[model samples]
Target: MIRAALTSNVQVKVLPGPSAVTTALLLSGLPTDRFCFEGFPPRTKGARSNWFKDLATEERTIIFFEAPHRITESLEDAQTAFGSDRDAAVCREMSKHYEEVVRGSISELIDWAKSKDILGEITVVVEGFNPGTRQFSVEDLVKLVIKQEEAGESRKEAIAQVAKANKVSKRVVFDAMVAHKSGDKI
Candidate 1:
């Protein structure tokens, strides 16, 4: 929003208005800090599936504006991409008299979406990826590094490869290696 700024075409002024994206986000009862708004999801099923797959690993809470007609489809794709247990909220008719919000796991939302015909503008908020839940033990990391090394990669290269593949830092992998050699717990 430009505040009293002049563009190449015309002058613009800022106006106070409630953001449906943020409004829906707040109503969803998810984390407000570090959220991202992704405008309308892809239309085609294949493309939407691919897009959601890529977004599945995002750490920041995600907000998406969607059409009522596509709500069920989007929820299905989301469940497939983010897994059935991911927390999410579907907000309908945001900032209006008939506003409604359904909060639950992705699978539960899918059931609710298919339960009845949906109406009005839709906003979907999904909790960020929880890395803690998908952690790899240091022993696991060391084994991965060893596997890569057995595949003809040097120790440095194997460490780097294992770190990148596991979405961990090189130092973490190095520590794991050291711990393995020292017979110390990670």
Candidate 2:
């Protein structure tokens, strides 16, 4: 019924709200030059995990919406996929009487969410991947490959897995592994 009431002559504009994307961006202090709004993430754990994995290497600031009930679980998934130390902000009840914005590492936010009875609409803003600041060491890659191997992945499969997780080429992982074997610095 609301859709039918609109016409080409209508110059409708979205009402300004505190929890809106623009407001969230302002609160986050993240880069605004490039961004991607993902809306709501998948509800299921498996699907949501996969979605987060796909976005792990995104270079643009990411935005998403979540309900109060699911905020904790969503933050948990985000922590797992983006790492506990990744910077993020959780904005709650924007434009409302009790508007709040919490900013910190993903793990800290998760801890905060667990202790509070969150209410009202929620908006999440996450910092994008910055390669220069967070490069994984060769030993780190080896540990990742070994972890994957322990989980039933073959050597070749483990290399591929680590490469994908680190957003690097498989060849790079292989080269690192070989360097480690020969006692050469990567």
lDDT of each: 0.81, 0.81
Give the poorly placed runs of model 2, Cα more than 4 Å off.
1-19, 137-165, 175-186
Question: Which residue pairs of candidate 1 clash?
Answer: none
TM-score of 2: 0.72
Candidate 1 per-residue C-alpha lDDT over 59-136 given as tens digits, one digit per residue, 9 for 90 to 100: 888999888889999999998767789888898876567777787999999999999999998889999988766566
Q: What is the lDDT of candidate 2?
A: 0.81
What's the CA error at residue 4 for candidate 2, in Å?
45
Give TM per candidate. Answer: 0.66, 0.72
RMSD of each: 10.7, 9.3
| Clashing residue pair totals per candidate (backbone < 3 A) | 0, 0
